[model samples]
Target chain A: MKAMQGYCGFLGLLVSALLVGFLAVLFTLVWVVHYREGLGWDGGSQEFNWHPVLTVTGFVFIQGLAIIVYRLPWTWKCSKLLMKFIHAGLNTIALILAIISLVAVFDFHNTKNIPNMYSLHSWIGLIAVIFYTSQLLLGFLTFLLPCTPPALRAFIMPIHVYSGLLIFGTVIAAVLTGVTEKLIFTLKNPAYSTLPPEGIFVNTLGILILVFGAVVFWIVTRPQWKRPTEPNAKLLQPNGSTPEGTDYSITGDFGNVDKSDEDGEAAARKRNLKLDEVGQRSTM
Target chain B: MKAMQGYCGFLGLLVSALLVGFLAVLFTLVWVVHYREGLGWDGGSQEFNWHPVLTVTGFVFIQGLAIIVYRLPWTWKCSKLLMKFIHAGLNTIALILAIISLVAVFDFHNTKNIPNMYSLHSWIGLIAVIFYTSQLLLGFLTFLLPCTPPALRAFIMPIHVYSGLLIFGTVIAAVLTGVTEKLIFTLKNPAYSTLPPEGIFVNTLGILILVFGAVVFWIVTRPQWKRPTEPNAKLLQPNGSTPEGTDYSITGDFGNVDKSDEDGEAAARKRNLKLDEVGQRSTM
Candidate 1:
């Protein structure tokens, strides 16, 4: 299983690296080759250029890498707390970029005197971004914040997991449609049907996006590929004595921590405590 | 847990129903309202009409529901053989539709003397359809057939699971991009940016596709949502005693079924044998 896991993790990393690299190239092509519009908040098309670059870099690429954090074997050696920070941090960045990208589109529309949320891409993208932002905020309050009550964490954890993954998928869909929307609006000579170089490049980018999303989801959701737990004599303690919390909500424990078994409950408590301890230490 | 499962299953069905309904409406608008081209194999745009309808009906919606078979609680009470058959049957229908859709597109392109596989939508859609077809065939040969050795079944099971889900996601992405491309290519006066009624309709459909994909993936991937095993005394037998082979690969049971314990190994053997027996009986 270890060997298999290592192989799986390696493949995941390879694909993810390709995904990120391809996205970077795509961004370069969009910014450098096709548009040459420098990034800013109010430069019209230049500002709109930031939308795809930042969204791809932050939303698509970074968010994907974040989802597969648990599948990266190298990260398994680190404390679960550190992993959470990475996950939450990546998501936060993605959310910020997505917000900025939205702003860019709106700014472009406003300056151009175009109506907003006209296309399906905009509608879906807006929904995905809003949901992602809300999910991140909820995750921060429930899992990252030291003051979040345990009961509240337990109650909200399931919805958080469901919403997080769903938004990830939704955003990928949005990105695909967004690319299509952009290409159709921009392409004239050697129409999309003509398969011009730019058309081919953009299409390849969309394919890569789909592949990235699929591989990331596969790595993240497959339980068999989950990181192996480190040896902890008190890992399954049914008491609340651990220094740090080892949150199992992501693992879908959903408050059903074997409460009937004192030992199991203690273990759950310890996990969450250790997670919190590690998180606080990192923050400090 | 049962109550929770019931609630979840109900929600899943509702979302799925909405997905199917929305897809139907979207297809009607494309074929009947917007184009009025009707379906055929050689009438140019008329022939192309089948692409969206078949792809959405078979590739997107049916494939999604198939992936969530294990999550449907009603299937939990039935023999695993019946479940597998239903799963395979749905996939078969989806594959057929996808194939027909592809044929329609190529036929339309050929009859109209237009170049094919030029757009990003076409490229990604082609890849997704091919991968999906191959996945279905491999899954059928490996799991549904008796000649496949247990070891091989176990080995291929994970990849099959991963590919099935990934392809499902890819198709959804393809559907989205396809919608965007089609709307942009077709709409003229009151352009897509103008958010004409047809544009709004198509975009709404894309949004629904995203939601459907997200909900289905969530239901299929969540371990807790897995249906409970039925109360057959022979169900857990670790030896080759039962009539049918109840392969549990999608349930993520990698081959290490208590190999350290002879009794456990025997029990697993019995489970598979029973599953095979039940499968054979159903075939008869």
Candidate 2:
């Protein structure tokens, strides 16, 4: 019964994440097409509309999904190596869309003779993209490449998870700021303060994005939901036992050193040893 | 040598957090007073200036300090109960400031004949404040009140930490959006997009807030930095050993259950047993 409840809870949250994510994208589309000019690339205001659309769809929603991909129970049956590719592929798609969105805004700005990268939104959004790109490259090298040392992968894993989530959060901040900037600039006729339909719609979209993010964070942080080490993994010795003194308990916020990639076996073993040392020491 | 390095790293991040937090508040003041109107309560825009200043100081800065208070190595020697009070006190102060800031904005809007709670900034900001208030009160009841059961406290502990960080992140989103809104509205003479000095100043302030937040998250999430289970805590039996099958290996993302509060002894024991059961299971 308890297991059933846990399963139900996970399903409910997953559904909520998807529903809110879809609504957020739909709301952005309506806000742009129905309220503002439709999306375009003619060096016009419409070209800039693609920024919010792609940002919500790719940067916020898709990146959020990438963060929690490992937590999905059904995916547990798949080999960790396969899951890593899916994770990386999703993130790559999000990055591509983000780059295109950046081009849209910059292109529109240049054509319209407006200064670029001046607003808090642009500053933050650009930095988040740069950080995301760096994180992606480093993560791929550390977790996916065969030549990287297991010790190094173990060392970088926590930093990788922390930075990934941090970048996701920074993206949310940028999106919120970008939405505010857009509304302020575009809501001249009815004025944003009048509580116009577009204002309420876009505001709802912003809240949905936040809710989606909260759901993703909650899913990924639940220790019970963390991906388990595969039975065939080499973390277990030939005798089918974990190494002596291995501390399985020191799961960080993202949990268990992500035993779902190519280096996961050696990485998990090395990380467990490191965490054991850290856990034993009371000071540092 | 390693311990010294860890300590220095902690200190460096701590100093960075403080520096950025102070600068964020200062920039808000300068942006409001030097660029726009100074603080006031005459039911005017000047009264509204208090909104940004107080939100950054109380909501973002002090509240951030409260979130990472337990991670400070110096504080590990202090009683957990005392730290709880400090945490609650700081959050209470932030709540009070947030209330006053909310009133200022509402009053200014009424006086100016502008509708309230219309923009994405207001929507997200108001929800964040509400969530913060609820989280503060619930945290107090669950973690502070002596009548609460240890089992219950353990169950709620993770949720509390997760929500606290989530609310902190939400406040940041609100602050970023608020800054964008203010710059767009106030930088009309020079135009925000034209890269006015005020615009650049406030944009930098927004980035500072993000950096401060990133630093705080890093400090608290580090497994090496989490407060240790106290020596005399009841989780360690009278014989100075954990109970059989206790599974001390299952430390969660925040580290060992907090061992400083009044309920630390019983709560830690109960929490460990629960985690042991969950950890042994291959699936939730």
Query: Residue A147 error for model 1, in Å?
Result: 2.9
Global Cα RMSD, each model: 7.8, 10.1
- The TM-score each candidate achieves on chain A is 0.76, 0.84
* lDDT against the true structure, each candidate: 0.65, 0.75
Cα RMSD for candidate 2? 10.1
* Model 2 stretches astray by more than 4 angstroms: A234-284, B236-251, B254-284
- Native-referenced Cα lDDT, model 2: 0.75
Instruction: Evaluate model 2 with DockQ and give the value.
Output: 0.30
What is the C-alpha lDDT profile of model 1 across B1-284, one tens digit per residue?
44444454555565675666466546545644455567666648877888888888888877877887765543555777688899999999989988988888888778888889887778888898788878878888877898887557655665777688778877887887788777777877767778887877777777777767766755654443444433462344454222222333343221111112213323443443445455457668
Position A26, candidate 2: lDDT: 93
- What DockQ does each listed candidate score? 0.27, 0.30
Alpha carbon lDDT at B182, candidate 2: 79
